[model samples]
Target chain A: MSNTTALPISALHERVEAIFRKAGLNAIQSGALARVITAGERDACKSHGIYRIEGTLRTVKAGKVKPDAVPELVLQEGSAIVRVNAKCGFANPAFELGVPALADRARACGLAALVINDCTHFSALWPEVEALTEQGLAGLVMCPSYSTVAPTGGNKPLLGTNPIAFGWPRMGKSPYVFDFATSVAARGEIELHRRAGKPLPEGWAIDADGNPTTDPEAALAGAMLPFGGHKGSAIGTMVELLAGIMIGDLTSPEVLEYLGTTTLAPPHGELILAFSPQAFSAGRPGDPFARAETLFEQIAGQGARLPSQRRYAARARSEAEGIVLTAAEIEQLDRLLALGLDAVS
Target chain B: MSNTTALPISALHERVEAIFRKAGLNAIQSGALARVITAGERDACKSHGIYRIEGTLRTVKAGKVKPDAVPELVLQEGSAIVRVNAKCGFANPAFELGVPALADRARACGLAALVINDCTHFSALWPEVEALTEQGLAGLVMCPSYSTVAPTGGNKPLLGTNPIAFGWPRMGKSPYVFDFATSVAARGEIELHRRAGKPLPEGWAIDADGNPTTDPEAALAGAMLPFGGHKGSAIGTMVELLAGIMIGDLTSPEVLEYLGTTTLAPPHGELILAFSPQAFSAGRPGDPFARAETLFEQIAGQGARLPSQRRYAARARSEAEGIVLTAAEIEQLDRLLALGLDAVS
Candidate 1:
């Protein structure tokens, strides 16, 4: 009656998975994709939620990502590196297959890295780091996106929005997490501004001639700026070196070249590093977890909020009251399920 | 005939080391301290060069740092963490003692971490990461300073001007490196402004009452803002967690509490992560080093200057023409050597 549907978390996941399956994604791909999408919605991260499904399916239909490919795990024995070849599929399943082994290696070696290659990557990196936090390990995750951001002092786009995410486990509480794009603003932000007939924010972008511009159209035709000026640009470059070239995968410019457009998920790689507190803090005074809580309490005591609190709060709400979707959103979901790959351009 | 004198790199190192030794520093402390200070001068990084010698002696005179303490390395068998307890000494010597083990572990484990605990730290972090680059590895180094920065949305100094430095080895060129304070600017910059009787730029800090202020005096008594707002604040907090709390050492606030003054070096911990590119790129296609050069070339082609080029250029100049010190600098160095621990209050 209210033109909305309240679905339990599982119900929403089932609906999303069913849609991916109908679109010809294998069980592993569909399930992993559905989980991430559902988690996005649960956390109220609308940008990465079910809205990504169409683009994902479009990538599959365009022969950009392999729908039925399975991710392969290469456990480099006696080493701290765990490799996962995504087999041309989405990065979600690849991350899934690698997390357990990564956790094991981290515990045994005290620090470990998981490298996922040949993956069509989507979803916010928080989910990936949160997975490690759930396993009681501190983690860092990073990956390259297609080139859309210009290195500071440069005119053209050469660096990706290259996201970096970090998480620390907290006992009996939600983990401490932060994930962000190195760019001043995400490309989708400019897209929204363009659609809204709005001028972009100052310092967010530069025009075609490498001069600052506020017009979203000019910005789109030009380049986005990295956050924090050169510092952020340097970080974006480091991501290219570490998560891209160091992992033997496509850099952001190469990803853009491969895809030819930004509409579809880009093929690249991911790097995840896990650190064990028990191993790191061994023989040293103070429990790392307890000390971290004190730091968090002091931060809050000073009236500063920790990162990812809003997401965690929304997750709690979603768990209690279910995910409420509007009529239009429900219709879109239904249409996608009904028409499968034919629903997209 | 002139108000300036030029000293070869070796002469400067020997002079700085003699002053430290006269000030009661042991061989390891004097040698390591001299190396970094000379490197700073050689690179034209005036802020960290011979200018920092008085502060070093002041800290030593105040008994905040152990002048003769030895560092002990603890190699956890079968683990990727190589730790060095600085025994209340300077972090430089501790870092030097741990690097070889860290490098070995990184080569063997694909990734490794070096943790330096109980050290009085006062040098720029570029030297730490550069040491790893010298060993043909990619490295990241981070450390917490005394609390001087406010977390975003907080009005008080609840975080440190934590610095993170990263480096990647390059073939036949200077290694790629970037090191920076997470705060909008270093505390020293604000102090310099105070000395010059100048107002700070807007958004750099908040007054004691939690309102924005450009008065350097108010900013110092209040809190410096993190760079890039919440993102940089989060990174600063991460430094506290990983480098301070995770290493079982003092956090920024605790360091402030322990030191009772920001003028002296803070006793805390440092975390250095090393990655062996050969191990990481073993089964992957393309050479990581060569690929990084391509990325660098494109960035430069677009007119973006890579970080640390200026320093590398200065090093080249110093190597050719020696380091030039102004008259005041020469006088201060001679006085510090003459007076030793009595040079400062």
Candidate 2:
């Protein structure tokens, strides 16, 4: 038998959705979660793909997230803010519920913000931003995770690996997009190194005694450092202020305290801002989309790769050739579909 | 003779305003410019203080900026975007003219953006964000300067240093604020290194041929690197897109092409976003400001320094003891006020 089995993207989505539904997730939650996970697999972003299914089930088993959440959208007259209360469910569904209104508000206001509160978040932000680009709008997305990274110059973990993502629409091409954690390295990277018994590169983390260290174990026990020293640290702090407190949601430390462990998905709030290029560039000379092409050309002409190129390329391939899953992955999926929540622990 | 002279902040502002007025700037432009420059000096940020006045006059003398042009505000009913057409003047006055309307719109809409177009921008962004903080709002400001930094993995200068600034209001204290260039090192830092006969730092810049170089002169002839590698580069690129192309203003490369030299200030548009915490945290559990204070205390408890602390400390001293200027600086100010635009080549 072949070591790998190929499945169409739609087929994989159905399987994932089945597993979530079997685990008692509501239709909205299961569908949205499966879609994001399937998109992750299609883009060759394995970290967020099927690998995340177990964690999702574990969180469900632990009762950290509501299995049947019905998100409610709140739209105010003459306001540029679109809000969605997730009712303690997964953030994906809340985001899905809010995006259309967010798009409408952005079109009307030139720029608008979508705030999703009281949600369990565990997916990459790129999908949220990518959705805006699909609607011909530029978008930025941010949210706080569980606290795991230290502010620069601090000895303990107080800041999360708060991720920031940005997307810009292009002319019949993949939108320019980038999503990255403010920390020097993700906690998973350190965890992988610890499992492999490898040492971390310098500057990634500090020891428990507040000294720099290379040992992955010590670094994991201590704290990961913010990227680019003070500059990245400041950006992370801004994320806490804007996406956390400003949104009236739980900050990273609060999420950690609520969950009591890093294994569970974080319950917090997310901020997504959308901008209508047509509205902003209405009186301007050049078409914003065409002008953006020129900028990308200059960047690529000089041999610099645009962000999200790799993921887009993988997406194209996956669409054409189907996503290939290893036999072990197939077995894992089968077990998940068969056992549901009982499969996790 | 004493090497330095102490002057009240108001006195310094008057002297600076007088210099601009003599240089042929309109009353609005001169007054706004003087206030920002004086604020810089009061905070001990010498780079943007009196040191920048000469450059402003140089830009004026070169006919790159309008000295006497008046900025006009353009407001559309029910829109969150408050625009100011700089009328080819300095950005300071345009920003000053739009801030009040911006604040009002933010309060009404929960969030708002102020766009200043067609201006010569040289002053630091902190003052702009700080102005929003003074109104009890959180603010974010960004603008594109001349292209001097290279996109990561690219050999040539294709992006600006692209500074980003953010400020959050605090109760009974200076706002939490940070402003920084996306580049690993500012162009001035490289020029200073060259003047001091010091080699450039590693990872700071690339030679004209695209290879890394520690020689300051070679680096100056080449391109500076973005901080935090690809992440910073993505942010710098985003600035060019949102603050530049999206706003229908000049991008970094376009600014460089228009000016043909980095010595002259770049004329571009700016984007300022203001968010209302009261509107955002309407029915949330804890007070956002108090929660932010908790976050700050946790950071400080771990021995981490908050951004802008030093500047705030200096500001307190300047307010209490008056601002002190070096004798040489005083003489320069006198010469500029006396000679006006004729002082520059």
Please give the CA lDDT of all the candidate structures. 0.94, 0.94
Tens digit of per-residue lDDT, candidate 2, span A1-345: 489988999999999999999999999999999999999999999999999999998998899999899999999898899999999999999999999999999999989999999999999999999999999999999999988888988998889999999999986888999999999988999999999999899899998888999999899889999999999999999999999999899999999999999999999999999999888877877888888999999999999999999999999999998999999999999999999999878
Model 2's CAPRI class? Answer: high
Candidate 1 regions exceeding 4 Å error are: none
lDDT of 2 at B78: 77
As a whole number from 0 to 100, the lDDT of residue A316 in candidate 1 is 96
Model 1 chain B is weakest, by summed lDDT over 10 consecutive residues, at B1-10
- Locate the minimum summed-lDDT window of 10 residues in model 2 chain A: A279-288
Against the true structure, what is every candidate's RMSD? 1.0, 0.8
- Residue A178 lDDT, candidate 1, scale 0-100: 100
What tens digits encode model 2's per-residue C-alpha lDDT throughout B1-345?
A: 389988999999999999999999989999999999999999999989999999999999999999988999999887889989999999999999999999999999999999999999999999999999999999999999998998999999999999999999999999999999999998999999999999987999999999999999999999999999999999999999999999999999999999999999999999999999998888778999999999999899999999999999999999998999999999999999999999998
TM-score of 2: 0.99
